[model samples]
Target: MAVPQFQHLAGRVWVCPGDPDPEAVQAGVAVVADERGSVLIDAGQSPTHAREIQAALTAAGLPQPRWLVYTHHHWDHVWGACAWPGVEIVGHETAVPLLRTEAARPWSHHYLDEQVRANPRLGPSFRARARAMDSWADFAVLPPTRTFADVDELPVGVGLRHVGGGHAPDSTIVLVPDSGVMLLGDCYYPPPAHLRRPDDGLDLVLVRRLLQDDYLWYVSSHAEPMTAEQARSAVETT
Candidate 1:
């Protein structure tokens, strides 16, 4: 398989490509930096993906993240956070309790078994990576050191808004006002009528409101960054 490449969105924002496994549900990691420090929008799917993200940051001459902001409590987005020690992890308040759930258990062989069964072709690789991730003591739930009730501001000039929908309950949207870039973790996805849940209608409305602000670039977890206009249309229509 070809090596994944990190794409630069704009001013101090770069995205590390995610897993290419057809059965994998990983999200790309977004690295943002400023004079204050750096922040990661989300850690990738596994320990391997996290290592790749770290390498990419070093290659890009960016500092280690002082903060890891989770978009939500999904395994694909927050599992790799254990790789970054001493970094203050941040997320919405709802995510705190969710992180402590049995589902977040790193060493749970049952979870790995289920994944392997779900993707038989990639089962061996998935099991191998799971074993590696489980080996880390810190691999267990690395709950957010800092939690926000609604909206919060980071020193890097990015705003974390609790959009509250999509794939998870604690869904968040990251807005970098200075860079005019918005990182919409898994909050937004392309067409597939079934993917559009009725419960997320309000969330879509909230996303539309944020997109009304001055933004040039819109980055989603699973797809290439799109222009502000394209993003707005996607949010409004889908």
Candidate 2:
């Protein structure tokens, strides 16, 4: 798959890199900004990437996000969420369990620790920030004061609909009804749907069920912008 790059699509939507890995747990991040403010969809893997997202938001002239939507509770997506202090942290109700407990598990914490391993020169800095800035449940996860299950519409200044969840059990997408744009939270894979097994993360089968047609463009939390046609094609294959 091609490396994802930030692109401004029509209707106040944007996608940008959330980390140096750009794969697996630390894939990337997506942003939905509008006149009202911005909503960060699925924060990156760690505190460093989270901070990076804040910087990007500033560059875009968007107000600090009023909401931070986590596609699911995976470490890569919500771990750095603490970086966005005041925004509401939204996610599938099922996802909260992992957010509250997963970080404490030896494997979960260890795996996250492994993700920080990086290029020789970048290793030191990545290591320092990764362990120092573990996910702050109190500040990040608590704010989601608003939540829904299976389906929900988050109004990010502009409307952002949380669509299908083919990645994780709690995964979903952020849809823009007007521009036909959607921000997929780990919906597909590095690109989408076909990159992994049907049962890998979320039920790709169940997630694909929501779309009866391909009328929406998309911005994946890990991938790049895909047109309605592209999305429909992937849906067909799935």
Cα RMSD to the true fold for all candidates: 4.4, 6.6
Predictions in order: lDDT: 0.75, 0.59
Tell me the tens digit of each residue's lDDT in model 1 across 48-158: 678878887877777888889999887778778878877899999999888888344545567668866876754654564564464555466666889999899987787
Taking all chains together, each candidate's TM-score versus the true structure is 0.81, 0.69
Query: In model 1, what lDDT does residue 70 have?
Result: 95
lDDT of 2 by residue, 3-71 (tens): 334567776667775444432336567667765767777776666666776776677766677778776
lDDT of model 2, residue 94: 70
Error of 1 at 228 (Å): 1.0
Stretches of candidate 1 exceeding 4 Å from the true structure? 20-22, 103-106, 114-138, 189-206, 235-238
Report the number of clashing residue pairs per model: 0, 7
